[model samples]
Target: MNRKTLALSAVIGLLAPVLAGCGGSDGGSDGGEAIVVGTTDQYVATEDGPAPLDPAFAYDTGSWNVLRQTIQTLMHVPRGGGAPVPEAASKCGFTDRENESYRCTLREGLKFSGGDPVTVEDVKYSIQRVLDIKDPSGISGLLSNIDTMETNGDYEIVFHLKAPDATFPYKLSTPPAGIVSQKLYEPNKLRDGFEVNGSGPYSFKAEVKGDTVVKAIFTKNPDYKGDLKLRNSKVELRPFKDADDMGKALDSGDIDVMTRAMTPEQVHSMVDNPKEGVQLTEMPGLEIRYLGFDTEAPTAKEKAVRQAMAYTIDRGKLITKVYGGMAEPLYSLIPSSVATHTNSFFNKYGDANPAKAAKLLEEAGITTPVKLTLNYTTDHYGEATAKEFETIREQLNGSRLFDVSIKGAEWSVFRPKQTKREYAVYGMGWFPDFPDPDTYIGPFLDKDNFLNTPYNNPTLRNQLIPQSRREADRSAASKTFAKIQDIIAEDVPVLPLWQGKQYVAARDDITGVEWAVNSSAELLLWELRKGTGTGS
Candidate 1:
């Protein structure tokens, strides 16, 4: 997800003001108490007043965690993961052999939380607004393939693509395609504040403190019509300032489950010394961290300099030192979990050879101790980010070929500068929007890529990406993806650092923890319940 800049446009003054409500009791569904989930993910409002909870504007995981519960997409990734399934739509598929034209029929009797009927016009409006506003922080890039959208008899919506895109159905499963009420939301403007009108399994009332969302109380949406079955009737989401605070809340019983932003130390503690009445669930994850370069910057502008740095940094040591072995060394933008993954970086640079690094600098006729500035966000990723960058600095400096300086800022400050290409080099993390290998590779390399960097490879962007997207069978596109990875390694626009594993710490009574999060890292809050475990 792109955690870039929030739009600063003035509020349109059309939508209703924020709504307030009391927390629910646990005695509503299956004899369970209200499930309280703790997270360190923060959602802040723009200075002009729109909050990230709006599906058209939210591009961060924090906002999506809440939106997925309230906003119903036409298609959704299944509980475990494979292919996209119909959610608001009765069925969906590409209509043409070229994989260009796509169509979906809305489910019968679908209604929003307020009992408004979900019509094809609402679906068309919801998607059109995202493209029209085109918030720099939003996921509009995922929908760039759409040439036009058409409605048929108020029940079906058809999409015409500029080119073949087999992944369009997967993109529709994301929050950017979430259907909103046309009567409630503006046609061309964002709905300010945290109030959401959606057709998902649950409806929420948010409590905001200034820009931050302090708490959100969610109760079952009685008018909801969807595929998911609500395991619990009531749920509460509490956002903390940090992992320590979130962990403390979990320990004190203020929250029954803790998921995102847990520190490596906290994870290890829970694994080694089990807390009473708590259990840990570990799952394979597609989340990845990497270092990106501003290709037009003075020092990093040199290709050899970028390659040398890549050769000198050891992923094994960095993961061991900072992540405490909680992460695995990543060799390509696509994580190993994907079928198309390749160890292109390892093949090109090998295992952190200082000699190779020095030789590249000498061959380029560059003097020793190349001065460079590396930027990172202090708050977005976690506290461990500082140590991760520090370890990187030491590794590069120890090679005697470069002198690196690190700068830190909060996400609000850091993302704007990074997008403006102010930093020569910066750190970034990715939680794929979908489970496809294309999600891992496309967002960084597409012409309208999320990174907003000057780095561009025409062969990769124009030829390979489109070539792969044309193939309906993803496995048939593996060779093309491997070629794309080879080009990425050769260009060195970004350096893959590590891939993380997903972990959730929760009380033993919390059932369905294993299925609580989908393959794309979206919180499936409806899957969680207060009962004996129904998952492995």
Candidate 2:
């Protein structure tokens, strides 16, 4: 029975655009076949674009994985659950100094999507080239700890380190740090993300410029020896301009899966809409929406003031009411899912207490009209955000403890602005760099942290961060983050808000959905199939 032919009479198009199941027009032809997965996301493959297909680039660049599917990193961290498995490299390891001194032994005879043999030179060139681009885009920041690399043999390569970065292996598994072929890479014109070449399960297929992309087709790499999460070779990705359109196709039987986070309002409506053919799976994410205070010198110098801010607002209600149960109130910078998590802040601040906040503020010489402004990203996170900020405003304004002003900026402006320590008080959300406590605590605590907004803590940078990474054992690093989390709670440079969950809508026919602690958690397209309308 063709999956597409499975009762067309039952397929009734909605009044508005809704999503349909997989295998509609393009995935498989067998077992009630064909899966057409489309995202409402718009992508740019031009030089000025983020270059969607580069593996060592564009993971959480957000809204650009249309081409990311066609590239392969050394490993695939499906839903970032546990340890990563091999993808491009057969087996890779650090000879010493974390991933600082690392080597990957190539599989016997792997070839690129263009059919060039996977070799040690490609691995070395890929890592080295990203450094040439010098885009911290995140990987450059993580790999900055590396000093140098050179091929040891035809099948092996080794890297040198600037520091003892234990997360090096894990970092290599990151998509932003993926390997690329050197043979096809043009050093003179490396900025072109559109002309992607890689050794992943899927190839570029057909990128209809900007509006829509049709992945020509995909198949298993004949020489693949690396352990990866999925093996479906015939992966195809279609591009739709709007999620509503995508949803219409989803409801109308075109695409197979959808997982961008929606406001709690949307989620509730989804829960209530009673669309008979579709299924919704909501998973708690690790991203926490909170306010970041630059407490380095004059801006956020007083501990009592920070604590008063924390005690004045209700986080639980904020998550449930502002987020509509789409998020869980978080007490720690590190969520419970990560290692070395403790409820130091929760233990301290039980609930919202305006009376206590007033006294604390009074003690700090801060008055009711302590004018603090908040900043937010207009388009980056999700729909609940604006309402979330409004809720915070009402909470503080009602308390007579604050005269709050809010500012909103797009991610383009916000990213560099926050990095320059431009905001006095701002709103930001962070998806973990990795699933560990270090990822939760380290980057924020580092004096030169990516957030760029400094927290006035020299010991955190000079002592905690440097000491933790220098520790040879990774577990030792976890313990360091525990202390770091406590310091964060004590100082309150950034308040702990809510841990966002990953949500997705897939047709009953689609299978294989998972998420990990890392940032790029989504269906790999390389590993999905249309079931007999049965859940995967």
Candidate 3:
């Protein structure tokens, strides 16, 4: 992937005001069998925007939400949650035990939403273009393993890998690997504008663009040959300023569903009050929030100092005081539900021991009252982050071994700066790109990891990760994942804080709320249906 340029921050700064101007009437059909869903996120030149629907350029949740429904991939996480399954292909798997070579054959009679034939050349070109454009912040991390691509016939394609990558197929199932219409997109650059062309369950229609996008329209693709059958004829996506606005819209019957941006307080209120016409679906916990540090920073370079900070922080207190117990403490980088997850950090640090932390600092010859700055985003990470970091500061200061100061940035600015490693220590959250332990461990260990924190553990980066990727037997591979967690705990580059439950609030009458969130934590709009009160 190409290195990201800092210009993205300026581009994102313009988005909020541009989107704030998008206020207008719902402009959607509410009386009939229409379903409207919204998020507070703005459409922008960055990954968050709802426009520029081409898969190569879109990476953030907003773009991924639209792409997951409108574009077809080789495989996908089924609605209601399960393993990745074939979507456009009849089948795909490795033909070699070394995991270096793979092959797939397209389902017969496959065609794009625009009626173009889904040929092997189209598949080959779509994959190659992602590498060619190489948007620094794009999902190219998912495709970095490719060595070469070859095709035998119109329907057959083979992938020759640079290394044995067991999670390669999982990568194919994500938005970054979305197959495109070769006839439409330029092979060397991202397609311009919001006119999307794909072969998924839905097809793109006119976007309601203002200074910001007030709404986006989509209709079922009559030509789509994938296994998924749409329950709704059209999908209308709107954006609200926050969850409170979205809750008001849902209560006022202005929209049928609300997917994200609800604070824990708002969610709890809904659970207790039981809004007459609304139903809240509390999804299984799959998200992780954490603190990451720059290993190369002078303050953090000392291993004992980092470990001291880890042992001193009280995770239980953070969950209760900052999150109000809306989240559970996370002991490992991988969530506990996954088989590969291991509580290495918890095993090493236990609950919290201030005395042990102080001793560690003393042994390392570090002076008392070390200074560190904690950074977080005010808006994107939710309003609770201020409290979360303040709680962290209190926990550290209580030990009397360190002095902590807190700083806040809007997500647009924060992301770029963090990626550039401007902050010595910072808070971040992760939503899985695909459902696998490799998704959690591989990126951070990669030499060009997304964290951009200065770290290069040759054993984890060059040996353990690639070794784990070579195992076709996932059960056997999990042992290597356990080893990885132990190494991460020893290093303490990132301290896992807590895991949060996914929440979706919809009208009580809306069917399929249970199926809306897949195992990967992606929102599947196709699974949603208007209530039986609205005629089918």
Candidate 4:
């Protein structure tokens, strides 16, 4: 999946000094009280079933946040962000020089939250089920490389790949690869509802209204067997309808920390006029917002139409006017932070030019003021999305070459429709599954891509991606990735907009705010605790 950073002084320093002396305390270590964290993220049931909590279908950040706490993968990204390290497994590595065969040995005495032994069979079953179900909206693509799985004795599991895949271990580190009890989950069907049963740092019980998760209360999983140490005994995750509500909860101390969907205005308020006992923690992020196209749709079917709109979109204007300069204008699917990134779009289109847009349309025999619709989710991204689309509507309309109408839907409705390619052009944001350049490009360009778009190029999907995956050294495949980015810019199936930095607004009494959310944008709820300091 193409997932979803910024500079320090220009962004963070403008916000506030990085809070110092904010350390976790032992006071709350004895199960003192539940630490309530507020987020504007919503988890809803989809056509794939009410399996948002199931590792096979928990593709989004909201679901993964809860899963990361309760579910244990064989390998996981470290708290401070680095290469994957063993979590449930004692050790894991490629068993061959070809990077095709991989093996992992489970840690001794590993058990599920239900207190059942976590055998190698459970590990094989968990991954096999994801491939069996293959939910279009789920993360089956990450595990598509697996040709077969073999078990050795009771503690070891081996994955045989379809081809050489150096990134397989990173894929295993994500929540989608989280091990589950085979008894509780079906072999070919997703386990429904909000109940999560895994061996991780915490165990959770959730409250749901309709299909949306309203609240989730996580207690320390005493049966948990993992490398992570829980800083707080309990964490209650409260979901808000919007940033305003979440911010109010933080201001009134209804929640100790507010994360995920804080608006630019709310962040500015916190930065300029700090709350008495609250502080904003900024960290490097790879989250990105972009527009996806249904290549088969009437107006969008034409390559020139897609190219014309790309020429007319002023990303800098969108970032400055809508985001208040809190985000960077992204020109490639690969964000600037990735080593293989290139400014391919900027190199091709230069800047937003209505004249260039008009010329392309005229050459393609298309009429002026081409009519089209732009779709976006109302609640999932943030409150500013409405204004962000409005800014885009104005930009496209201002060009006098296109007639654009913007449509908004709640995520539950938006996600299914977008995946079905119901909209001619839709907006979506990505939080990377792993820290790699492939995570940015592969998901959108591959044949079994998550976007469900029809713009497939053999060179990108069949050739370059596999070529890049074959090389054990990721940096050595930069030229291949550059070619991949060039094809994406030319195809215009998706247009890059802006990349954002992560922010967590927390009360000074809350520590580990910086480490609470990892580089991949997954919430490490176990990292947060009640602090005894004045500074954040």
Q: Which candidate achieves the best TM-score against the true structure?
A: 4
Q: Compared to the true structure, candidate 3 yields what TM-score?
A: 0.88
Error of 1 at 176 (Å): 0.4
Which has the better TM-score: candidate 2, or candidate 3? 3
- What does candidate 3's lDDT look like per residue over 1-536, in tens digits? 21111110101110010011111222222244558886766554444332356677665666678888878888876543345678998889899989999898888787887677888888888888887876645357678789899999899999999999877888888887778887788887777556777888888764555434577777878888876757777878887767778878887989887777678787778766666667777655567888888988887788888899889988998899877746889998987767778899999998789899989899888998999999998766567778889999999988889998999987666777787778888998877787667878766668556686678888998899999888876778878888999999999989999987666777766666556664345767776777543222
Residue 103, model 3: Cα distance from true site in angstroms = 0.8
Residue by residue across 181-294, what tens digits does model 1's lDDT show? 988888778888889879999888989888778999889998888877788988999988899999898888899889887899988777666667777777556689999998
Highest-lDDT candidate:
4
In model 1, the worst 10-residue window by lDDT is 10-19
The residue ranges of model 2 lying beyond 4 angstroms of the native Cα positions read 1-34, 38-68, 78-80, 96-100, 183-195, 205-226, 229-246, 294-305, 466-478, 514-520, 533-536
State how far residue 252 of model 1 sits from its true place (Å). Answer: 1.2
Cα RMSD (angstroms) for every candidate in the order listed: 8.6, 7.5, 9.4, 4.7
lDDT of each: 0.82, 0.61, 0.75, 0.83
Per-residue lDDT of 22 in model 2:
34
Instruction: Give per-residue lDDT, candidate 3, residue 425.
Output: 89
Report the number of clashing residue pairs per model. Answer: 3, 27, 2, 5
Cα deviation at 91, candidate 1, in Å, is 1.1
lDDT of 2 at 196: 62
Q: Residue by residue across 1-536, what tens digits does model 4's lDDT show?
A: 11011123322221121222333444444246889999998877766456778888767888889888988999986654556789999999998999999999999898888888999999999999888988877479889889999999999999999989888888998887999888899898888888899988898899988877889999988888778877878999999988899989988989988888888998787777766877787777788899999999997999998899889999988889988756899999888777788899999987798898899999989998999999999998888999999999999999999899999998888888888788999999998888677888778877667887788888888899999998888778889999999988998999999998878888777776677776556788887878553322
Instruction: Tell me which residue pairs clash in candidate 3.
Output: 43-49, 44-49
Error of 3 at 8 (Å): 39
